[model samples]
Target chain A: MRSLVQALGLALSDYRHEALFSACSVFVLAAVLAPLMVLLGVRNGVISAMTDRLLRDPRTLEIIPVGSGKYSPEWFRELAARPETAFVVPQTRSIAATISLTNPNRPNLGLNVTRIVATAPGDPLLERYGLPEAGFVRDEKSADPLYPAPLVIVSASVARKLAVPASPQELKDPAGYWLEGRVERVLQGRREAAGINLRVAAVLPPEALGVDAVFVPLEALAAAEDYRDGKNAPLFRALAAPRAEKRSEKAVTPENFEDYSASLYREREYASFRLYARSLDAVEPLWKWLAAREVEVYVKVEEIEAVKSLDHAFSVIFGLITGAALFGFAASTAGNALAGVRRKSRSLGLMRLLGFPGAGIVLFPVVQSLLTAFSGAMLADLLYLIVAFAIDSLFSASLPGKAAVCSLSPGQTLAVFAAVLAVSALSSVAAARQAADIEPSEVLRDV
Target chain B: MAAPAPIVLALRGLRKDRRTERAEHYSLSVPALDVRLGEKILISGPSGAGKSTFLDMAAMALKPDAADEFFFFPGARAGDGRACDIAAAWTRKDIERLAMWRKHIGYVLQTGGLLPFLSAEDNIRVPSKLLGLSAQKDKTARMAARLKISGLLKKFPAQLSVGERQRVAIARALAADPPLVLADEPLASLDPENARTVLDMFMDNIEDAGTTLIVVSHATDLMENMDFRRLILETGARDGKAFAVLKEGPG
Candidate 1:
């Protein structure tokens, strides 16, 4: 250890006058590495921000089955049995449906042609969109079996169109203004059922999908369209029955009707479904399972994975470029060391004559290289800080998350430091070899 | 009579060849030679007589062609009566052995080959530092005072005159108090008065330190007033072998 210290001291003493050269080497290394560090930092920050944004919104975890396909009651029951299933709700086929909303007190202001989105009770999306639990349970069951009152959650835009006052004073007077809802099938041009009234239980923020639509109970919408569980297939079948079969159905009393109803209705079918997993981990597996069954599945997992893959590819490309730059730095350092050895040949010979071993002399160049590399790495870190600050100030407002746009983590900084030291150590090999091979006799003769 | 002063250095059948592109010049062959403890020997030869080559071979700084034996005992008392075979030392090519040999022997070049970066005092202390010896400030100061270079100890080699540089070099060679000192044309780059003074001080210091000396030079007149052994090398007419002949006994 003492020998090593002496060698270091000697190297420093010899290089004291050549400070400018050392500084130049350090500057060149810093210039090469600072930009790469900034690039890596930006990639990490942007990707992490986007990923966090998706994870923050639980709706990204929803798995929807796409295309025209009936979800039978048995299929929903089976899906609900899975341990990872959170809430499985059946959705109505409301593709061409629209709703009209109006305040009874101010009929002049109305919401016309607003889209209708129907969801079942106990749906997890209600909580995700910040709806109160009471809103979901409101009007859960009605006394009359034939007709049920619909509970609606209107978006901010729909509420605004209806001229509903958002203040607490107006909210306390429920009788002051009543909102009415009427569902219409515009594409089919049909008006076969009575229009049902609805009361807005809550209003959603602009960020939610329901902001531009009116959310209502799926059963209520089905009743309004006279849409049965199986689209009234049994009624159509009964009406087309022969006269003898129809007379037999009329002979049964209402009290005894339950006995014959077992064979009355077929299984229900849905056009599509919205599946909510219990956690984020179940989304990918459930999507894959449904996709394998020839059902088109849509989720945010694919988009998140695409962004991550792009970030990884960017990192690899930046790493390759940085590696090339480091190689060039090493070559330049080795060249300088070789030249130094030639210039200081006489001093090295004198040390040899003084009984210093070749091993000791070799440490001279290695120590110098280490010092230079460490200094350059420190300089690069300072430069990185400045660059990161400038970038964050310029682009933070445009970024999504609260964090800065370009910031390096501590782990990344340490990795950069270790890499630079390794390259510098490798560069000193040739110079050390030359220093060891010097002959004191030849040098002394020349003197 | 007094046990003949144990042999400090002995060699038998030492030979070295100097080859050049134009011609084969200056090949040396020494049949046998021995130097007693505290003996001063002067080697006088012409320009191409291989005087410096012999000193280099003895110091283990250069390789010899072939030799039956070459040995260097540490001191006159000869610890364990063991001798180091110079030829064997060269064959191993071990850096540790070279360092050990250099620590026990001191070589003074013609122009005081001191590192230009280090001060005069640091140049003198280089041997001790490399060998990891204890503090030698007292010894350094005494040597500097004896060589009349006390004031120049803090100055670099380039800052000192030629004579002063030579004095510092001699001080450095003797700093470790080695058993043998080799001087190759130490007076070559000095005026007459400065050369005489430096030579007197060198001889006095060596005698006081009880160190053996081998001085190589072409000027025979420098040794006219001193009683010393004279080794002469001359090129033979037929075999082209330069043989070193001892002309006087040890003084």
Candidate 2:
């Protein structure tokens, strides 16, 4: 190790001997590189910001089945276990997924039919809608004893439908209105079903849920489907009424009677599911994965394309600048190093005459060239950081807490370093050749 | 009787051809010669007689055109007493091994060949640094002191007088304790008085180090009293090519 250091010390001394020349070269390279660094940093930051914004959009990662398809219970479990699946909730067929909601306190409001969607914790839309983290339960069947009624979160439209023509008490806080869900079966032109009283835990704003719907937990949606399909819902006593009463007595029978039906209905297989990818980048892979598994899905292909095109545009701009800078640097460095060879021929010949091998003589110029380039690149990166920080600070006043407008990722930073190394090495080729070809005896003849 | 020293260098039937402006080309031939350890030899020749070419061949800088035997046994590298076949290394184009062998030889240029960028001290330390001679860490100081150029150690070669430059070059040659030192007209650019001073100091240092010295010079009258084996190159021209053959001469 010491011997290698001793050998390298000579080259270092050569660099130190002409410190002014070296410093000048370093300054030239730094001046050339600083603007390029800024350009790349800005490109990286803007593209990253665009990608992140698209990724944050809930629909960007949504995967909906093309048509109704039966998904077995095991399919959902496996899909949930996949690394790409962020959240999934199996949905019942749309025909049986509707329920009429009413505000019990306001008898004047009529029944308003609303679609009920399957929801669970970590639903992106709900998460972005700022769902209160604590009160929401993923399964209504497993709800704590304190909250017995089935809980549902209503959309702004649904809330307005149930709260409008507001009673005196509801006019103050309409979003927290109590709701009752009624499932009815008309037989012989008479409505003969009971109402299942439900509570509206929270109402999402219009930005999150544009349509009038009730966000029912997955288990609750399944139970509702079961009750409507002639299956016994043991917990949903209002919908579990016996359907076998004689025709004459049916009219007099009371609603909400829990005489369990003996027959069972086919259940648990869902028509489709609402699935989200773990990330924006995972969307395509997950889509492809589902397609490969014969599960046809509909994704936001055009939206994803728009996001990718942003990266493509940045790449084009970066490529142009990189090509021009690469050529400029290569030409400048080759010219500089080759000129030094001519200027220092006598010195090089002396080294050759002093018993240094051809390789050492070659390294004499290359080492100095690399030193200048390396130092110059370091300075440029430092300058870029200062400039980026200044630019980002300006953004802090306007778009506070958002991503910076000028920054480079670690990979981008490494690319800059690698570019400098490759260019420096390529530029010193002519100088190294000239230095190696110098004959030791040339010193004698030239003297 | 004292034990005889090992041969430091040996050559036989060696020849080199160089293109020259003075003629279409010039050829140098040395039939046979053996240099022992700690011995000194001098070659005096007329201008254009290829004296520098001989020095070049000895320094391993110029590959000879033809040779029967070309060898160097420097007695360097601590205790590894191996004879280096110069001809084989040249034929194999093994530049690394050639450089290793060159570490044992120090060449002094006609104009002191010190790098203009390095200080006088750095110039003298070049050989030791290149050869990684840690044992001779203070050789630059001792050599500068002996040459009386300690005051100029911090000055670059361009800042030194012609005499001071030559002194620095000599110190550089001896810095690594090379077994062989080849001086090519070390006093060529010096005046008579400065030449005498540099040459005397150079010789005293070589003798003190007990190293072999091979000097090529044209100043025959200046070295009239110096004792050494003498050789001369007889220069001639035929068919636009001047040829020189090595021959013995009285010292």
Candidate 3:
């Protein structure tokens, strides 16, 4: 180790005398490679961030029952009990329900179209969509198993359409331009129903949901449409009770609506329900399990696969470019090393004449090559960091949510460093051989 | 009677072939030669008489044509030291042994083979450094002072005059205190005054260190007053063999 260090010191001293030339060589390499490094870093960072963002949305892992089938409440309970099932919320038949928004201060703004999505309070999509907590209080006297609040979360575009004030001061005032939400439903394709008013509980960022979608509690939509629980066979049959000749004049409230609407429907069926998997890995297994049961399933697995393929394609492209760059770097370094050997032939011969072992002297050129390559890699890394920071700073706001424009992971940095060192070391073989082959007789003959 | 000095280096029936594009030629043939411990011998020959080749063979830098029975015993303790056959050393592929052998036998080239990048002192210390010997600075300084090159130690090879460079080279040759020192025309580049001074210093230092010395030169006039043995080689072909003779005294 000490001898090796001494040889390295000698190499360094040799380089010190030719510092400018060495620096130029390093700079040439850095110039060729820095841009490539930045390109790969950006490619990896953007693609990974996009894939991660999509995967993080639990909705992407949803497997919906596509075709019509009878799914009992017991079946749903069993499915939900599985460790891989995060949540299994049944979809209501009122898929055509649209909501409109109005701000009292801007009455001139017309009703804007919005799609209504039904969700339970504990639905994972709520957290995935970054919605605030629903403030529903259960009444002790209420007999209903589920009583949903009238609150709704609107997309950012919807809030803008209603001209709702986004400032904290204005938002604190209950009367200051309260955004009015109204849900419109058609009953059995006959009469147009009056709109049910709802309060705007929160506004989601544009990235949270689709452009014009609004989220509401599932029970609220079911009650407004007088929809029965089709998954529950017993409940569906019990709801088919004969109607009395004289109907009760009292208005049906959310508190006791289940008893009043018992004789509405008989069929134990459902259009579909969202099936959430515990994780991305479980999504495929759960989909396969559900498909094996003869249930038609739809998932974002294709999209996930596409993202994976794109990532792989990018990696191959990056590998090709990096391979080419490394090849060029190796060739250039080898040429430089050969030239250096030719120039220092005398010195090498003198060392040999002094009884220095050829094996130890061979490390001279290799050490110099490694030092040059290491300096170049460090310079390129510095340049990459600067470029990444500049890009992130320049375009951070335009990026999706908090994603950076460019970044390099620790693993990627290490891989690049290793690759550069390996290339540099391998390239110096010819020069080392030349140095070792130098005979003390050559110096004698030359003198 | 005092005990006879043990033979430090001996060779018999040694031959070396020089090859070129056209044909092979015999470079050197020595019937017999021996140098005892602490002995100084001077070799004089015309050009192409294999003077340098003989020195190269002694330094183990060249391979001999014959493959058997050439001996070099390094240390003074004849009982403890073993004679290394030069033919076997030539055929062995282990470079470490060659390096070790070279470390024990110093060579001073015709023109000083000092690295241009190193100072005179550094050039002198190269062998010591190569051998990983510690505390060689004092020895190097003493050699430089003995060679009258102490003032030029800090200068690079290019900065020193021819005489100074030769003196530094001689200092470097003895830096490691090898048992055998070989010089090919050590005083050829110096003036008469510097040559005489360097010669006296070289004899004194080698005598003090008890080193066996072999000096090869073409200057016969320089060997007239010296008490060292003279080995003269006449270049000629004899009975299908090109050979040289080793005369015991000034011829």
Candidate 4:
């Protein structure tokens, strides 16, 4: 161990003594290494940005079932229970799950039909837009409560149609807007419509959906479908039960109405539901799972795959370039090290004569190569930093606040430096062999 | 200390074959030789007479073509000494084992083989450091002072004069307190005054340590008056092969 340290110190001294020659070698190494570093940084930067763009849009993780299909409650429960499933909720047929809205206080605003999308507590779309989730909540804000059922959250498109020239009080808090929600259908070739008072809870941005739409609790969509299909709605039927007998019409009050609405029409299967996967990696498995059951979904798999393939292509290209560079550099360094041993044969022979072991002599070149390559790596790191800073400064506007377009993470930088040293040591294999072949007698007889 | 061994090195029937630059076969042989502890010997020969070859053999850097017996005992006392079979190590190509014995022997090259990268003091300390001698620090300083090279200790080999480099090489050899020291033309590259000065100081230091010495040189007149065991290589050509044999030379 002491001999090894001595060898290392001797190597350092030798390298310093021949500073100009060593500098030339280090420059050549850094010249090759710096470009490869820049390439790797760019690869990481571009791939990270592409991946972040994909991840930022939650729709990329969504897996929507196509059209209408019989989705069992157990199936939905399983889907929701899946490790890949981020969120899942049962839905109804599109035709039956809709409503027409109008402000009852203003005659100017007319009723308009809007599709009702089934949403639950973990609806990604509503949450992404900073809107309230569709679920039951206490109405402490209202003096005279309208209903205790799920509140209606509308998109900006529908909210605009239902909005009247608001009074000052209405403008201050528009979530209290009362809209008369009516569901219409034709049963037995006759048109029948049922009206219900709906309160606006939150208005989602149009980015959620362009056309008029309403996000309601999954139960609300189920009840709407049942009422339109001529099935019994617990809330609507309870209200109409006393009317046919001319009994007291005020039997259903706001506090007791929740008990009536909670008893929704129960079904084993649903027509549609909102679903999402936990991550991009989860989407393929979830998509494959549904496809195995003959359920086709309208997921953003192709876009996700596009980004992933781009990442793969960049990685392959980077690997090829970096591999070629490292191999070439190692080869060149080996050749140079062999030549260096030959040039310094006399000095090396002197050390051998001084009782320095053959192994110590071998390590002499290895330690020198490490010193040279480590210096080169430092220069490469400096060059990479400058290039990355220049790239980020030049292209900052390309990704906005998303990410830097040309930079390496700290871990990657360290890996690159370590690889440089390892390869440098490996390059000295030939030199070590040459050093071992040197005899102490070379100095005596050469003269 | 135990009683000193009478014989420090023994060799018999040592021979080597070589090819000259003109493609002529040449041979050098040593019949039988033994040196006692504290003995100083001079090997004088003409140019191309195999004096360096003899030193190379003693240094264990050149493998002998054939050897009936070749052994070196570093420690003169029985308790601390063991016979080192240099011939057997050479036959087996056991370089590590041979390198281990180099600790007790020092070889001074003809051209002052000093590492150009190291300072004069570091060059002198290398042998002692290689042996892991605990007294290396003080020994190097004392060797440098005795050689009158204390002022030149901080200078690298390239920065010093030829005479100074030779002195440093001599100090490097003696600093480790080896039992035997071999020098090949230690004064060949110097003027008369520097040669006399270096040779005298080298002899004085080795004598103080009671180390056996073997000096190979082509200059016999310079050591005409010096009292030492003298051997010389005699060269002759026969049957298209030139041959040299080592034996006692006229004092």
lDDT of 2 at A132: 38
Candidate with the greatest lDDT versus the true structure: 4
Error of 1 at B3 (Å): 2.2
Q: Each candidate: how many clashes? A: 0, 0, 2, 1
- Model 1 misplacement above 4 A: A1-5, A17-63, A67-296, A299-320, A391-406, B75-80, B236-251
Please tell me what DockQ candidate 4 reaches: 0.63
Using TM-score, give the best candidate's number.
4
lDDT (Cα, tens digit) per residue for candidate 1, span B131-183: 57777999999889999999998898889999999999999888888778888
- In candidate 3, residue A238 scores what lDDT? 22
Better of 1 and 3 by TM-score: 3
How do these models rank on DockQ, best leading? 4, 2, 3, 1
TM-score for each of the candidates: 0.68, 0.78, 0.75, 0.82
On a 0 to 1 TM-score scale, where does candidate 1 land against the true structure? 0.68
**Of 3 and 4, which scores higher on DockQ?**
4
> What tens digits encode model 4's per-residue C-alpha lDDT throughout B1-251?
98654777899999989987743898999999998788889998778878888888888878889999999988763335578999999889887677778767878887758888989998888877777777677777787888999999999998999999999989988888787899999999999998988888998898788888999987667877887899988988899899999999875
The residue pairs that clash in candidate 1, if any, are none
lDDT per residue, candidate 3, B21-103, as tens digits?
A: 43345446777888888888889887767788888878877667773468888665445467776677667755546656676
Question: What lDDT score goes with residue A432 in model 1?
Answer: 71
- Cα lDDT listed for each candidate: 0.69, 0.75, 0.69, 0.77
Error of 1 at A315 (Å): 5.1
The TM-score obtained for chain B of candidate 4 when compared with the true chain B: 0.94
What are the root-mean-square deviations of the candidates from the true structure over C-alphas?
A: 10.0, 6.5, 7.2, 5.5
Residues A310-427, candidate 1: write the lDDT tens digits. Answer: 6567668767876786667667666656766777777777667666667777777777777877888899889999989988899899875467898778998998888778777766
